[model samples]
Target: MDETTLKENKINQQASTTEHEEFHTQYTTLNLGPTHPATHGIFQNILTMDGEIIIDSEQTCGYIHRAFEKIAERRPFYQITTLTDRLNYCSSPINNMGWHMTVEKLIGVEIPKRAQYMRVIIMELARISDHIVCNTVIGVDTGALTGFTYLFQWREKIYDIFEHICGARLTTNIGRIGGLERDFSPEVYKRINAFLAEFPKAFTEFCTLLERNRIFFDRTAKTGPISAERALNYGFTGPNLRAAGVDYDVRVADPYSSYEDFEFQIPIGVSGDTYDRFMVRQEEMWQSLKIIRQALDNMPQGKHFADVPEFYLPPKEDVYHNMEALIWHFKIVMGESDVPKGEVYHAVEGANGELGFYLVSDGGRTPYKLHFRRPCFIFYQAYPEMIRGGMLSDAIVTLSSLNVIAGELDA
Candidate 1:
């Protein structure tokens, strides 16, 4: 009776377990993108989902890997700005300035106070431009297109300022090694003043459209949350880290380009959710405006570029009219100038976060080794963690809030 009863019980248990296994839910694998517009970049995300909620995710980058660091190694120091232009194109000026500062530090060139102030203004303008892209894209992902279309005009105005300063707008190799190519012209000042006066009201309206709107708040408030501790562990910076309640701003922690001379508050959020990220960037734009105003108001009177004739080029008029100036210009442009042998690291509070340049020179025209500390690349590794347990829609908004530029990721 014991052996027969035990055999029967085992069979019954096996049948019960088989039935339970059949009833268990199965997860589906979904690929978000390498070319999908919703991804906002050329990187791919492979997601495991139960219905519409994500269970697990794997990210694949390098679809557009341009090997910017390698390119930088081959190019002369002056020509490297073109490569940086594509790193965080939304804020190319910050990348451009950061590289210039790294070279300046390595060469022991003292940047003029006026040049520093000018750099501050341009960098802040680029910051605003970068934040605008992030925050507005967040709106669009949440099905709010009005804010994006409206606020983008202001970004164009910022570009106009860039165009007036240099000849180019987007991928502006805007500044020279020691300082800017030239001082601000009257037209540039007029455009800047106009932008300052007009943008605040429009930006305020853009904020109002999404900041408290019930739909925007609900779509983003608790979605894609990361704790302050987790964000730091993942190496977050800029608005993303600030949204997680970290006040570690490169501009304030290690001031460069005269950032310390200005007055502004570092805005932070509590939950590090999508809403917090959005709000943090919203407040940051205001702070950028404040810095730009201060830089303009306290504009020091002096030469725009430092007295580093080896690096900074002479005036076009001089190059055209004077034989010596023409010869010097040809030599500098032709990579005939010598660079110091050294290693240097410089970081700027880039639009996404800390945009850093680690440079190694061997007394040559090109960098021996070069690396960029792209914030987008660092924080994007946390994307899967942020979007796990949330809806597929949440993934899009979370990425938008992080503002992970594809260019930075591949570079």
Candidate 2:
């Protein structure tokens, strides 16, 4: 009686367990973000889930759309730099410099080598700042919060350098169309050197915390992987494209702002997953450091701003004390200065990817049409595809590693 009764009960128990598992295999819809912290931006994903696995997803953008391209059509060339600041606010200086370079190309104003080197230094710092926020946030999403808080201090130091240079931190209207509005002060150099010297130690610590962590690798290594062909077809650039094993860095492919002068390597990855994205950003921060050091050491000597007095604002002291300076300042600020009718496109190696500006001028105070090739907007198109078969948690880490800034995406 014992053996037969036990066998019958065991069979019944197994059947009940199977029934329970099937009952719980239900699907639900989830709103991943728009205001969700894991999103890291003002974008929303409508996710269809089977338990924790993301089955399908739809992305909603334009929550922060400020119509940047349309705004550029109305504002004068000089006024447009402020709008760029709002794009990739994490690395606004790169947007500022990219916009300025676009106008310079249109007007045929050659930036001095010194000014180019200065721009390079600032842009590289912005790159470091951008990568820091991305890589550390990737850690945060992976449940390692300490690294984010620890490395944020270095981000503040980078912001301090920005504040010193442009008198603003987050949205730095850093350079003018022809060149920088002002040269870097000795104090700014001091801050940069200090950052360069100290950041490596903290960065090393940050990497040590997560790079080889078993949990982190398990969560991120193969999650949200995309093939190189698909990534490139989607117009991927910057680290996102690089993570797919294509080494197409705009700074290397089409050098601008004297990026040709400084030597640095493009960081690449093979899997195009969250882990690769994080690793690529980590390596890029190091490359940015290398570029900054080279620019500082081999800086050229020349005026920070070009000789285009008509377009560039006059010195504040001169505006107050000299009549001609006052007139030029008025003309430049009021958008009364004329620009030659032409079309031009300029791109820079932005923190996200390729930050490009395509300008068409009608020989007017404002551009006839201006378009920004914001990398965040372009790469975000690949999000649903990337996260399609991944888990909900992997989606968060993938988004963090992509570094899709709302301002940039919506702009």
Candidate 3:
């Protein structure tokens, strides 16, 4: 009785083990980026998927890394803006202006009120330009393309303003070390007014399309949510952090370029999800418009740049005609002027988040050392955590909402 019963029991247990092995699910590894359109940039993610769900993900940066910090060490202060241009090409003016303000801080140059107001207008325009790309792309990822096409035209109009300010459009090496290269021309004012009048209606229509749409809401509402605590822990700033119900804006916390003079609300959201991120950026665009209006109305009466002729290039006409102006222009452009021996850090509320520049000058034309606190680089570290346990599609929308510009991420 004992031998026959024991053999039968062991055979039953073996059958049970075989059945368990047969029914178990097999996981798949997928490469989601580094050239994929859904990724939006040169970023790669190795994802472990359980069917359509992402269980784990590892991000790979440096695919577009160009060693911007080391390059800054070699280039002069004036030349560094060109490098910043590539950092956040979506909002190149903000990068350009941030670098200019950093050098201005290091050299103790006080930017004039008029110049500051002009900067506010340009930076806010850039912020709007950036949000247009991000929010529209989020819609596109959710299978809504009409809004993207509708609002992208306004982004081009904003680029037109940039072209009028400086000759270039994208990657504009726009402002000078002390202030802007030139004041706003009458045509620039007309363009700004035209944009101010026309853009709001188009933006409102774009918002109407996705802000309350059932499909978009279902796709983005709870996807890739992070708490305020985790967002702060992950070093989030800008719309991403604000979406987590944290209202810490670099412009409000530490005002620069006369941001303190402007009165505007900082938009915040309760959930750090894709929808919240999109909404926060939408509201911020409105606030940017408000700030731009205030700056334009209260425009100060003065020169476009600061009084530091040593750093500011002389007028083009003066350079061609006057011998002294020619020498000064040559000296400034060639980085022949000596820089102060000091260290300074300056940050601006960039389109993505807080873009900081830490500069060390040892009485040299070029920076002794330079470091950029790129928000995309910092916040992209949290991508895996944010997308864990969510669907593969959700990851795409999440990345788009975060506006993780590849240039800034790999800079």
Give the TM-score comparing model 2 with the true structure, all chains together. Answer: 0.93
TM-score of each: 0.94, 0.93, 0.94
Which predicted model would earn the best lDDT? 3
Which whole-number lDDT from 0 to 100 does residue 71 have in model 3?
88
Evaluate candidate 3 by giving its C-alpha RMSD to the native, one decimal: 7.5
Estimate every model's Cα lDDT from 0 to 1.
0.90, 0.88, 0.91
Give the backbone clash total of model 2.
Answer: 0
State the TM-score for model 3. 0.94
- Tens-place lDDT per residue, model 2, 293-393, is 99989988878989999888888999999999999999998999989999998998899999889899999999999999999999899998998877788
Candidate 2 residue-wise lDDT at 169: 94
Whole-model alpha-carbon lDDT for candidate 3: 0.91
Better of 1 and 2 by TM-score: 1
Of 2 and 3, the candidate ahead on lDDT is 3
- Candidate 1 minimal-lDDT segment of 10 residues: 3-12
lDDT tens digits, residue span 46-146, model 3: 87776999877778789999998988888878989899999999999999999999998888999899999999999999999999999999999999999
lDDT by residue for model 1 over 1-411, one digit each (tens)?
A: 463355445545554666544766556667788889897888788777768998778788899899888888788899999999999999999999999999999989988899999999899899999999999999999999999999999999999999999988999999999999989999999998999999999998998899999999999999899999999999999889999999999999999888888899999999999999999999999999999899899999998888887788989999999998888798789977888899998999999999899998999889999999999999999998999999999999998898989998888
Off by over 4 Å in 3: 1-22
Cα error, candidate 2, residue 218 (Å) = 1.4
